[model samples]
Target: RPLLKTALLGREIVYIASIDSTNNETKKLAAAGCVEGTILLTEEQHGGRGRLSRGWFSPFGKGIWLSVVLRPRFLPQEAPKCTLMTAVAVVKAIRKVTGIPCGIKWPNDILYQGKKLVGILTEMNAEMDAINHVVIGIGINVNIASEELPPDLAALATSLQIETGQPVSRRELLTVVLYELEQAYALVNTQGFDPILEQWRQLSVTLGQKVDVIGLNNRFSGVAVDIDRDGALLVDTPAGQERVIAGDVSIRPA
Candidate 1:
């Protein structure tokens, strides 16, 4: 779109009325040699997904359901940094658009006043050491009302409209998101992950908190100290310090 000020991201967008999943479509495109920066935007996603294989709640014309195809020249080990960078970008975009404070929970969830406002899922294809492509899926609850959400999610999920007491233009938000993402991606490509990690720490709600992390077969409670260079969470447990690469983190009260 003309409103987008990014150099690469969102330059070639595939807009659809409906789809099973934007991530899935973007992967297909990436496999067929689609150029980097190609994006897929849909009004509705029938089978949207989130991190840890959880189902994302996506209703028609109520949210931003989109995925971007990227071919960054980073190794697979550095992929998690992309996810963290995206969280920072989304937080900045939300604050700029709605003037509401938002923070990122570790890994990928964006929180506003302790409730989830956005979810990001990043998937990548790689060789042993080199990444072939990455699809960053972003879903933001933009205009959904409180009552419209299921009772199970009513307590944990929120939207921009709900927080601001007015509808937000998805078009404007999407353009800003692309611009922010492009800036962050450029930072990662040029300067490295340190700047992105620093910004993420500034907007984090999980750091310096007692928390519980639930992995596939392991769980632990600790004080989240910092995120390592690889983007794994470093927690000080009763036994010792541990680095968590993948898990569901729940922040405990101070």
Candidate 2:
């Protein structure tokens, strides 16, 4: 409550103990004229989802699963920038609260060492040339022990308690994340993308490396060049090619 009040002052609030997906619920509320700054939270998500429709693992009371609804006046094309901004905010919050060094993978995965600790999915409703609303879903593994992770994710995932050698407060971490989110959101609207992009670059772990991009249509190998103004990744491909956007990339050491 304190976090939402600080991050979204004077806005309608919604809370749920269990939901199919926080992002989906946020979208429904937005379509029904829910105001900006409204938030939806759940302790367990039966149908939790990740980017590209992948299933997200969310156990009951084991992680932070929440979504924030926004009614920004930005153009539809600029929505991607907001996801990157959110990543920056999350990394900042993680560092501030836990004193752990977290790096952002392209798009919205937070990594520690080489394991994923959090994932963010952003969904938007748009009209012609303008955005109606955006629902940013954030999932963080807070107190889950290493033994509790799914077999597939056991070797590839870590939690706050696992990384920090002690349990951490989910409420405290969520508060820091929401506070940083408000700051980043305001900066993106007023200052532009450069500032956020710079912070993203500093926290990014995928830049200037060999990468294998696995997209919906095709897969290709490339060297990550930079992030464009619209936040799509720039890559240098084979056959002397250059591309502005690549998704699901596997970054390799140079």
Best candidate, TM-score-wise? 1
How much does candidate 2 score in TM-score?
Answer: 0.93
Number of backbone collisions per candidate? 0, 0
- Write the residue-wise lDDT of candidate 2 on 172-241 in tens digits: 8888888898888888879987999999999998887787777556677888778888888888877765
TM-score of each: 0.97, 0.93
lDDT of 1 by residue, 112-148 (tens): 8889999999999998889999999999999999999
Global fold similarity of model 1 (TM-score): 0.97
Q: For model 1, where is the 10-residue window of minimal lDDT?
A: 245-254
Model 2: how far is 71 from its true place, Å?
1.4
State in Å the error of residue 219, model 1: 1.3
